[model samples]
Target: MSPQRFELLIGLYGDDRMAAILSEQELIASWLKVEAALATAQAEAGVIAADTAAVIAGAAVPATIEAGRLWRETRNVGYPILPLVRQLDEALPHEHRGRAHYGATTQDIMDTGLAVQFDAVGGRLTELTDAFGDAIAALATAHAHVVIAGRTHALQAVPTTFGAKMAGYLGELARDRARLVRAREEMTTVSLFGAGGTSAAYGEHAVKVRTRVAELLSLRASDIPWHVSRDRLAEFGAACALLAATCARFAREVVDLSRTEIAEVSEAAGHLRGASSTMPQKANPIESEAVIGMAVTAGALSSALYRIMEAGHERAAGEWQAEWQVLPQLAALAAGALGTARAVAEGLQVFPEAMRRNLGADSGLVMAEAYMIGLAPRLGRENAHDLVYAAARRCRATGESLQAVLSDMVPGEAAGAVAELRPEDYVGHPDVAIEAALARWRDRG
Candidate 1:
């Protein structure tokens, strides 16, 4: 069977989810696009006659090609480019066959083909990021005023706005989008340096070929020969995995929130969810768990990509093939993770009532910070801490309110500071961070 057919059958593992990036139509379309680019580059540099270039362009249509036949030739030649070059050769009507591919190396066409795919994949990633950003913003808007006890060491340490917590995630996502954007450009550059990592075939024509190829493909010209660096390829792969890690973290948070005992938040579930024999009433977060599971594998693939960077010299077949396996898979998984993360964020339900109900453990003593601040002017900083420390223990152990505890320990100036304080006065400003995230996304297009 054809490589294209294989991908269609197994590329997405039972979920077509976001496998368009690896589809026969998409991958083969990239090859056709690069062939047209090669034709354009050759014609612009006077290497191929204008009329011949036109014939080559007319025949590069993706839909007209036989994918199975191309795959057969590729398998026979033991290289992916053979099918592409042979197909281009047959379509040239004999007159332009000799001029096709011109002075370009195999890596040149392969890298260009890869860039075309990156262009399409980059667009999808941007859309996924945007959808997730909208979801994050909605969460921030909805929870802007929900006060919750922020914890460290699994114990409440202070009051924080739930919106503020989401703001931090929104900030991280903004940075992730920026990194993905840069990785897209890095992956999309034209590397037309000829065979053996040099432009020897083109000779004095190398500069013209490089410049024209970049212009034809709307990509930057690679300065040094990147035919074998492999680092750029790995960086692109690593970025995808890193984005997956972010998705994993988001999924983990959802899982934490959905825990029955915690109940501070929950993933919205439908009637058919968790319909297994054992747990009919359960609302298991299968999507979140699936996304998190993909993240673990994506991280491993990322490490493999970096290992390929150690494949030094002109080229290493083993390392290159490893990349072909890992990078596309990483991209596919990242796309799925981002898509799932956006959905979770969009439908995530916050229960301020639950947060308030959960805060009974504080016994109104989570307001220790306010009391500390209130007494800072009275007993001096050190003494006020001593008094509040003594009083806080009473409140925690005996379930006493701060007001009652403070009555016994009130110092001269603290009486004045304590009168103005309230338990609800300590929530921090989370809306500022949300606005910052929204402003960052405005320039995404």
Candidate 2:
């Protein structure tokens, strides 16, 4: 194992469960599992002796294999499967030696092993994402009516509920959850076709042996050999990228809202968690920042996975090799981003008073839309817009409040309507949207 400066960063960004799923030991164990399942399938199909298959299956574990020897052999052989099969056969009695690998090819063993690893990773990601979604839903429900200034172009435009913002995140997370579940289902299939994907080695019992192996491994049997069709892996990567983007979106909002001037929301209190080295007063949004960093890396890595889809012929050379490096990193980064997002959601701090104070900071200017809407029925849409625009200019020029300026410019009924408008009153039906998001989450659960 080469020492890397970014190893600590990767650990912080990634989940321990995901790390275990993609570990070298686990990867080798998955390969052994595939080999064992293949032996069992061949035995059942009468292609190999039952006692020989049992002996092979019994020896299919990492503990029986010498890691140092396997590594050296793999380096010499240009792939791990040849060495792995050699090690497995060496572990069994001489009678069972030749039956260890049977009809399976290198791609069949490696691809099926990768599918098992991905299945585990997908399960963990689904659980984490569900927890994150629940946290977001709870936040939305708690603050469903808490109004804050809505910003556009980094300036206040109107009033919106904090719950509405969280609800939007929850909704997107819901869709992401569904997408991940589908990707997991699609990708968790056995790749058992030999050599050229025609299963010529297995002959008449190809489909039956493939199906039996899939059952033994708890995976779906592929409709055809996907030795060259990489869409399944690509689709899974795309789902992960979309999930990371959603997490980044939420993290960015937290970063923006936690700004010194905004102060509407922040990470939960921590004495030194976000402290800067030189700046004693600094309490940064470190979790959100880390999440964004992981998300950016995942996005870049996902592009590589997409590029690998351009494989040529029955098998690829460089494109196939590229996935061996890219997929694990992409999975790790995505899982890391999800872990950070979950932490942020569970510990988020909301300051309702600060949100209200900021809403009024512009002296009712943010409520201009409300005033315009109220006046549109009386003055016509264009005329009402002009009237509000002129009042805004006068208020700025005379250093008066927008409400006072509107009171002077409009007649009794229109002025009454403008005077009656509160920032909270203008936050149209965000609770309904929140309810919809919550309902969707519950239904999915």
Candidate 3:
């Protein structure tokens, strides 16, 4: 949140969703918009711009001379767009001062300005979400055939395809992608319900301007006032929250697999990977950690947005303006998170042998599920359950192999049960379920 970082996040929202919200060009554009709106409304009402709209539009250029001069004038308002308004006034000469921003509240121009900013920001979100989806799907495919120990409650449970685990993550991100789309669409609606959220000021022409602005920005315009209907904004923030949470979840998983105790997987080692200061043996997943940390800030940004949505009725300029900062920050955050996530996923080092070794480290004990299922048919459900359960209990007590205990279960002693069982027969449908999940993904497209 340093000043420079705060500013960079706004631009970098091109990569993630939370590091930034609005851009400088965005603020200027919105000012130019208020200028344009006034000019458009004036022309329709015979006030101005039947011919001067082009002049007004050209004045909005981010690199314009007037914009530079306005920058100098508004250096300290904490709201620079107002200086642009004065500068535009100077540019318009006299007969048009009345034509400028006529019959408009600051909210009128500011709201439309935000609508325009959100339009550009929303487009970037689509791109980032697409990248995240690609990363998850790619990870799922790459590891789909690699067997891994599926742990439950921090203990080994059964065998599973690494791809199956990744696919579960991918599924979560898929829902996230949909949530982002909905959030963007909801936030994309222009706030140009006109002055005071009513059409009284511009007479009959207010209707046309509202509709035209929505069309110009490729956004939907509501039939009624929503100056207080902030749910749409909350939707945008929530979408970012989901994306951040996804990143954190993915990062934590990477960290876990890279742990010394696990060592089943590691972040793809590269020349740029983190190095140790003392051990010289550590190649820490720093990028993964960074991604995890970013989630914290991104979540905060989403909360800021949620809080802003509780603004007083009609409009709240301060709260809305804060979004000018918050929204871009989140956008940049999600973008960067996705970028890092892609890098981490694509480079993951999976050890199938390690997975197999870990899968049954507890003295061939991970075969309990298969043993139960296999015995159910031979031992008449209840009897089979009691026998196997007792055997498993004895194995745990003595720290002996489950196979050793099963070997003593004799032919008639356990209702014709055999002791020559292998752990492979117990993994159930892990491979097939993984294959089917991937197949379903392919078909989903």
Candidate 4:
């Protein structure tokens, strides 16, 4: 019944749990929760009767509020809190009606509601990210010694294990997880400041009321009202963008390795899951494609959030309004990217023989670096590089193997060094790196 891609067709590019967290119904429920919490805080501070606070709390459930009327009034009033407060007050008994919203302002309810939603979203994202990292660690451990061609700038440069490549990604994911955890902790704070964030209306009891509200909502109380200081939200947005970019990096690797010419890896398929319309033999990297696409969208949305950080004065005219649209989209896109990445990691198909075939395709030219390093002690560094360069050109021109060319160009110790050099021999401690990455993931768990 939703109109957006993240809602209507969420299976393709969104997580249902994340979509629900950001849904309109949930937003309204969060606002009502904030109103109830504010009433409770005021009651604790002697600003309202305890019985009235309990009555307001009992009446603040979303089911008791009329959605259609609230929507209509929100449109007429240019904000939702006024209509929401009026509706909640009407739902209360005559004696307790006035205590519905207490001394809270529109932004107080709205901002605190956002914080509640953010706490839920952050927890879900953390769980998904941990699952994805575990999958990566498993893959790395399984392929710890499985050697493959290490590509640099679209060409094979040397040898590296698949585990090493996955380890690189795992390291980035760990850092991303840490950054997101910090940002979430910082941003999920209660926003209970009064109209102008000064709490002047509450006088001496403002801090106590704020603390009580935060405690009721299970959130952190801010030292000062952050009505215009949006860096916390911006930090969370930036972390999400970084996570999406990492997912895209992993997906891009899968896409390239699964290419027709490469065929070193692919996404698992069943029936006609990844089949093309015209080409019957096609089994596309659909999950990887989705991950990359969602990552790109998240990245763009994160940049928009950064721009919206400069809310004018104590409150914004347009910047704050823009956030209401951008934040949920960013969350949906990030959740989608993480889910797609998890699928990719769990169901990846690796072809060891195909990798070996591709690694051997260039007739041992990929080992040139190893050969040059071997010969450097004997021929001087510059001379050894020059010799290898000349031998590489000759091998390419004559369709001969680099080993054969090097055999003719160098003799004795230099030749022995070249003969000893092999693709697998040049992997350079990949297992050590992989173990280190897996250990980090384990520690995080």
Candidate 5:
């Protein structure tokens, strides 16, 4: 696809809320907000006069800074905080000019700004994940008895309910959501250690000022300096990556199940939705495809985040710069993927009849395990396995029904068990598993 086409598609399906939260305007605004909070906190700690802080805070709005000039100076200075502080200082009265940024380093404001952004992003993602989880829970409950073929290595293995499958997805999503919540909580702590990871410039009121600033920003205060300890942020990235990867797994399953040959499930249909350019009959799983793409992109970005953890002691030379470019994109992609995943889950179309038909596709080959397990108690496990294997071979070679071949192959004593091997009866305890998943989801909620 062309860049224009990609952008258009992304805008249509991507998480616009996340896009707005991570936009340049919002980022600059967050930085300014942090600067104002720092000034107010310093005043509270007696590092600066209240009136000076008031003047600085009044001038700390984003409109006081020029975007074009800010970028120009940022390019020259290799950081934007100084340019931002310069503009804020310029906007303040001469007496209060030097007090605009007040003992805080660039990382302090930037990192705290990120925490604010993540607070917003985390809330959005958590909402989406919960929505998706609810959808899966409903599906699992509704389809608790809907038998389907369980496959391994891309081929039919045994009977299983669609509810059980959806329960598995719910379980994975719940775990990912928990990880994201923990990471967001841990990563949202304040970053007020000065340039050298010490409060040398902050003097006696450093801890007080930092704690007050954190409180003002609605973030956690940490005494241990994190100027070089990037693990918390990386943990957040890893959580997002895991969530995206799980979304991709679900999407891939939808894509495979909705294929022309399988036709067991589909994304919701609409007029020309997911329409192919030339094939008039095609209605593709486009949203799921986009989810898979976004997940892959998030995974790749997460690698860069891990590399960032290798920053040298006390400061990152070039690694920190990459964060300005990587983190927002990574977060946006994860949100997009998750938003699309929720849509897919809520609008999914399931064909139980098709699932049943497909289960009998290879002449009841999918139920081979049912027969094996049925005879395992009568015959030894190895003997039952060999018998089912031979019967399966005969059914395949002669195009005969597995039920018929297995019925004739089983000893007379096991004839009753072979006769009872219906797919619905063979789907083991899906209701119990679905209930377990639903219980966990409720607890999370």
Candidate 6:
């Protein structure tokens, strides 16, 4: 495929770094690296002479192989490693040719090589996730006291700080980041079991060779072969899906808050940053929209991984091949989603005045619960709720503040108590919750 085919779309929906890591060249190079490591490990395990291992390793570089011929022969062979082995053998001295891919099967090299690729991709993703979290934490800290209307079922329900909203995003992302980190760690394990989930080909040196290869590759070594046990790969995809969903939640909120009627928050302004071609008076939440798109696509792609896990027996009939197509795309979509989320968050424009304005949009009915609680002590709880309910209806109908309506309906003592309740004062422990969230984010270091 032409590399530039998706260039335009990639800028909005794909991650360049992730794409590079999972590219064809990188995939071939990873396979070559695995061959080299296998030779080195075999030498250490006494399966091959050290000089022979060196000769194979020297010839294992991708430059020594013909990509066109390898791929053509792979088409006929139904696998690439045999063709790759043939190329490596041709590059080697006759004596060392036989030792090139000693004791390793096609799946062994492909799976282990994929693990190496995932290591790079996972590290990049973790960095992006952490950066996004940092931006959110900063927003949370900056807006800790900036109160906005808290909405439920699309209607104003109470008072809440924008910082607390940011903190909520931070909290979910922190947990998702942890899950991704763990899944990446688990997924990066070496796949050295020979054909049929057995190490019989390696004879006495199977465990040693696998261990040495894992050490050289900086991957985990497992005691059993996962030839058909694809849970690790499935888990990684699930984690990515979860992260995308969390980011989408935050993006959805940004889109809502940036609505023309709401106008409480906006994406940063720039020259045609979110420009409309025809309508010169429009600015959109472009990054957040892309984030949502990437998230939805990632979520859909990740679900396919579960089907891949249904592969039976010692090897998959065809399910294993699905991962090759699904994992990279899933990871790329997740990276795109997270990276764009960070961009939106870092450049987010928060308007405290707009937030304050929106808080009063419902004629101060949002503070009814606060007022009801304040009056509940003097009047009975049920009576206080009934009185506030009546006051809220009048406040909404007359376009007056809840305090004004309540004062007209209640006695002097109750009116005095209701007057003391403020929207800012009723944000409900956001300071404590935000601080705790900030502490958790810091500790993720």
lDDT of each: 0.76, 0.88, 0.68, 0.86, 0.87, 0.88
Q: Report the C-alpha lDDT of model 5 over 396-415, residue by residue, as the tens digit.
A: 89999988988888889888
lDDT of 1 by residue, 99-120 (tens): 6677776677777888878877
lDDT per residue (tens digit) for residues 1-445 in model 4: 2244534324676888998998889999999998888888888889999999999889989888788888888888878999999888888889877777777788888989999999998988888899889889989989988899999998999999999999999999999999989989987899877888888876688899889889999999986888888998898888888888899999999999999999999998789978999999989898899989888878887877767778877777788888898888777778888888999999999999998888777767898888888899999889899999999898888888888889999967677877746677889999889988888877774
lDDT of 2 by residue, 1-445 (tens): 3343466557776899898998889999999999989999999999999999899889999998888888888878878999898888888897767888777789999999989889998898888888888889989999999999989998999999999989999999999989999999988899988888889888789999999999999999875989888999988888888888899999999999999999999998887989999999999999999989988888988888867888888888889988998888878888888888999999999999999899877666898988999899988889899999998888778877788888888977666667657888889999789999999998885
| Colliding pairs, model 1 | none
TM-score of each predicted structure versus truth: 0.88, 0.97, 0.86, 0.97, 0.96, 0.96
* Candidates arranged by TM-score, highest first: 2, 4, 5, 6, 1, 3
Better of 2 and 6 by TM-score: 2
lDDT per residue as tens, model 6, 1-445: 2234553444666777888987888999999999999999999888899999999888888798888888889888888999999999999988877887787889999999989999998898899899899999999999999999999998999999999988888988889988989999998999998898789898888999999999999999997999889999998998888888888998999999999999999998999888999999989898888888888888888889989999998889889889888898788888888888888899999989998888878787888889888889999889999999998888778888888888888877776676656688899999888998898888875
Model 1 residue 357 CA deviation in Å: 1.6
How many backbone collisions does model 6 have? 0
CA deviation > 4 Å runs, candidate 3: 1-21, 41-47, 65-81, 379-397, 409-424, 427-445
Per-prediction CA RMSD (Å): 3.2, 1.4, 3.6, 1.6, 2.3, 1.7
Candidate 3 residues 77-174, lDDT tens each?
64564666666666654654545565566555666666667766666766665666677777777776676777788787766677778877776776
Which parts of model 2 are misplaced by more than 4 Å?
1-6, 411-413
Model 1, residue 316: C-alpha shift (Å): 2.9
Worst 10 residues of 3 by lDDT: 10-19
Misplaced by over 4 Å in model 6 are: 1-8, 411-413
Clashes of 4: 0
Best by lDDT: 2
The worst-scoring run of ten residues by lDDT in candidate 4 lies at: 1-10
